[model samples]
Target: MEEEITFTVPIRPDMELEVTRVASSVAEAMRLGKDKIDEIKLALIEACLNAFEHSKSKEKKVHIKIKMTDDRLEIIVRDYGVGFDPSKVKEPKIEEKLKSPRKRGWGLKIMRSLMDSVVINSHKGGTKIIMTKRR
Candidate 1:
C-alpha cells in the first residue's frame, strides 16, 4: 500500500498539534503500532520546533510531507528557514550526552536513532529533513 500525504501549517507553536494529527492519521492509515506512532510524532514535533525557532520571520507556514508503504515509511519536514549544515552535527558519546547538564544536539541524534535513514537538505530556500523507517 503506497500512499502519500502533504500539507503545510503555520510555524507558530499553536500549529504543533496539527502536525501531530497529520502524523497520527498517516500512522493509522499504515496500521503502525503505538510505539512506532509515538516515534513518528516525536520526530515531527522536533522538526516543527526547529522550524518554529529558525524559520523566516516573514514566513507563514512549514511544509510536511509523508509517504508510507508496507516496507517503509518516509517523511519530509521542511521549513523556510536559514538553512544550516547538517554535516556539522556531531553526536556526543552516549554517556556524555546522558550525563550532560543541558540539552544540545539531542534532536538530531534522536531523529537519527528513531529512523533508519535521515537526510537533511538545506539551502537559502529552505531546510528539508528527509527521514525513513523500514518496517
Candidate 2:
C-alpha cells in the first residue's frame, strides 16, 4: 500500500465498466495470471456495484485505489453514498439469497469469499470497502 493506483468515477451503473477497466489495467501491468485477473476484476466489480447501487451523492462519485506488492493486491472502494451500518450487513447465505425476494445482497459475501481480507468503514460522509488478495 506504499504506492497506489487510483481512479475516481461516477458512482452510477454506467460507470461499472470503468471499474473493470481500472482493475484490468493494474492486473495486466502486474502480470497477474488469468484466474487472478478475473478474481481481481470481479472483486472490483462487487465493490463498484455496491457503491453504484447504494451511494446517494448528487454527483454520484466513488474513489478507488489499488495497491500491489510481492505479497498481495489491495483494493479500496469508497463511495459518497448514503451510509450504512457495516456491523449489520449480515453475510448473505447464498442459498437464502437465491431464494429471497430481494434477490440481491450477495456482493459483500462474494467479495469476502474471494478476498483474503475485507474491511468496511462507513460514516455520514461516505463508505469504504477494502479488500486484499494474497499473491
Candidate 3:
C-alpha cells in the first residue's frame, strides 16, 4: 500500500529543521532503514534550503508533498519564485571549494548524490523538484 502527504510552509531559514523533522517522521513510520532515513533528512534539508533561498516571490513559501510505498519514497519541493535552468548549475569541484572557501551552491549536487533519482523543472514562474529514493 502507498500513502501520501502534502503540506505547505513559509520559506524561512528557521523552518528547515522543522521540515526535516516532518520528513523523518514519515520515513520512520514507513520503517525505512536508519541510513535511508538519514539520507531523506539530508536531501529534504537541501531541497528546502534551495527553495527558500532561490524563491523571489513576496509570499516566500514552499510546498512539499511526500509519497511512500513498500519499496520507495518520493518527495516534491516546489517554490513559486523566479526560476532558473537546472542545467546551468555546475557541479562544484571539491578542490575549488577548498581554494575559494565559498558558501554557495552544492545543494542540488548533494540532493542528487543522496537520492535514487532527482528531476528538476524550472521556469520564470516557479521551480519544482521531484526526488525519489528506493529501498
TM-score of every prediction relative to native: 0.84, 0.87, 0.94
Q: Choose 1 or 3, whichever is better by lDDT.
A: 3
Query: Ten residues in a row with the worst lDDT in model 3?
Result: 11-20
User: Which residue pairs clash in candidate 2?
Assistant: 11-60, 55-81
Off by over 4 Å in 3: none
**What is candidate 1's lDDT per residue for 1-135, written digit by digit as tens?**
788989888866568778888888888777888888888888777777777777673676888888988988898889877877777767657788678886466678788887778888988777999988776
Give stretches of model 1 more than 4 Å off.
Answer: 93-102
Better of 1 and 2 by TM-score: 2
Q: Relative to the true structure, how large is the alpha-carbon lDDT of every model?
A: 0.80, 0.81, 0.88
Which of 1 and 3 is the better model by TM-score? 3
Local distance difference test, candidate 3: 0.88
lDDT of 2 by residue, 9-101 (tens): 975556877877878787787777888888877877888888888777666788988888877788999887787887788777768877788
Best by lDDT: 3
Output candidate 2 Cα RMSD: 1.9
Q: Compared with the true structure, what per-residue lDDT tens digits does model 3 show for residues 22-112?
A: 8889988888899999998898899998888877867788998999988898999998899989989878988888888685799999999
